[model samples]
Target: MKQEDTIDFHIKRTWQSIAKMYNEEASKYDATMATGYVLLNIDKEEGTPSTSLGPKMGMEATSLSRILKNMEERGLIERRKNPIDGRSVLVHLTDLGLEKRADAKQAVVRFNEAIFSAVPEQKLEIFFEVISKVNELITNRKIYLKEV
Candidate 1:
């Protein structure tokens, strides 16, 4: 089968387009797609644990560490001692980070609104169902089982 006709091909292509669009918007504020994502995942009130930030964002610790470092350098985030857990740090957004996070949130909201407006409700529901099932299959190790 041609690559263009594959399921993953379309998924990846769509994701790349979305990522590119988000990155372009983020660049105006000197941020990147990952940074915006991190900002969004962080708890605005109590702060998020550093250890849990990666899992929340589906990111690796090392990769997240680098991003967190850059964010710190930019004064977008601050790492504080976790009051509940001394061994772990909590990531809190600085004022600048909060502003950027608002921008990121608006961008996401706009994208979702656009997609929702463009697609029929029933089709969007089916698309979500298919995507959920795809995730379920992967999580259950059902995608690559050995032949009987």
Candidate 2:
């Protein structure tokens, strides 16, 4: 089969396109798509636990650490000792972070609105279902199995 006809190829290509679009938009604010994603995941009010951030975002420890370090240097986030757990840390957004978070939120909302507006509701539902099944199959390691 042609590579363009494969499900994984389409999925990967679409994701790459979306990431590029998001990164271009984020550049205006001196942020990358990765940083914007992290900003959105962080809780605005109570702050998020440092260890939880990586898992929540499906990000690697090394990459998350570098992004967090850059954000801290830019005064976007502050790491404070976790009161509940002495060994862990809590990541809190500063005033600047809050502002950037709002910007990121708006960008996400706009993107969703544009897509949802263009796509039919029924088509969108089917798309979501297909994506969910793909995720489930991958999670369960069901792909590439030989038939009985």
Candidate 3:
């Protein structure tokens, strides 16, 4: 089969395109796609737990820690002990982080709006259904190769 006709190829290419677009927008605010994603996952008022952030963002612990460290150095976030758990920490956005978060939110909104405007409602629904099925299949390991 042609690469363009493969489901994985299309999924990967679409994601790469979306990541590039987000990275381009994030560069304006001195952030990367990952950083902006992390910023968005954080709670504006209560803050997010350090452990929860990685899982919620689908990021590795090490990658999340490095991003958090960079954000702290840039005055975008602050870490404090979780009130209920002495062994855990909570990540709260600084005022500057809030500003960046707003920007990131806007970028996301605009991107979604652009896509929504271009795609018909029915097609969009089907697209989401397909994506959900794909995710379910992957989660269940249904795509594994069979022995010859």
Candidate 4:
């Protein structure tokens, strides 16, 4: 089949578009799309653990480290001793981080609202189902018979 006819192609293309839109918005705050996502994933009240942040965000250690470093340098996040886990550190949002997190949350909420307003609920449900099924196929390793 042609590239445009493939589901993966559509998924990748749509995601790229969405990432670009988010990046553009994030640029105004001197942040990137990844940073906005990270801010949103973090717990506002109780800080998130440094170890958990990577897996929670599906990011590798090196990349997460870079983002955390940049945020720290910008005074957005501060690493504090994890009371619960003595060995690990917790990444808590500073005052500036809290403000940026709110901005990120608003951007995500507005985007979802816009999508809901534009797309029919039933159609959106079907779209979600299709995406879920695709994920399941990949998770089950059913897309390929042998390791390439």
Candidate-wise lDDT, in order: 0.95, 0.95, 0.94, 0.94
Q: What is the TM-score of each candidate against the true structure?
A: 0.97, 0.96, 0.95, 0.95
Candidate 2, residues 63-132, lDDT tens digits: the string is 9999999999999999998888879888999999999999999999999999999999999999999999
Candidate that beats the other on lDDT, 1 or 2, i.e. the better one: 1
Pairs with steric clashes in candidate 2: none
Report each candidate's C-alpha RMSD, comma-separated, in the order given.
1.0, 1.5, 1.6, 1.7
TM-score-superior candidate, 1 or 4: 1
Residue-level lDDT of model 4, residues 103-142, one tens digit each, is 9999999999999999999999999999999999998999
Q: What TM-score does model 2 achieve against the real structure? A: 0.96
The candidate that achieves the highest lDDT relative to the unseen native structure: 1
Candidate 3 vs candidate 4: the TM-score winner is: 3
Q: What is the Å distance of residue 142 in model 2 from its true position? A: 1.3
Best by TM-score: 1
Model 4: colliding residue pairs: none
Q: Which residue pairs collide in model 1, if any?
A: none
Q: Count clashing pairs, candidate 3.
A: 0
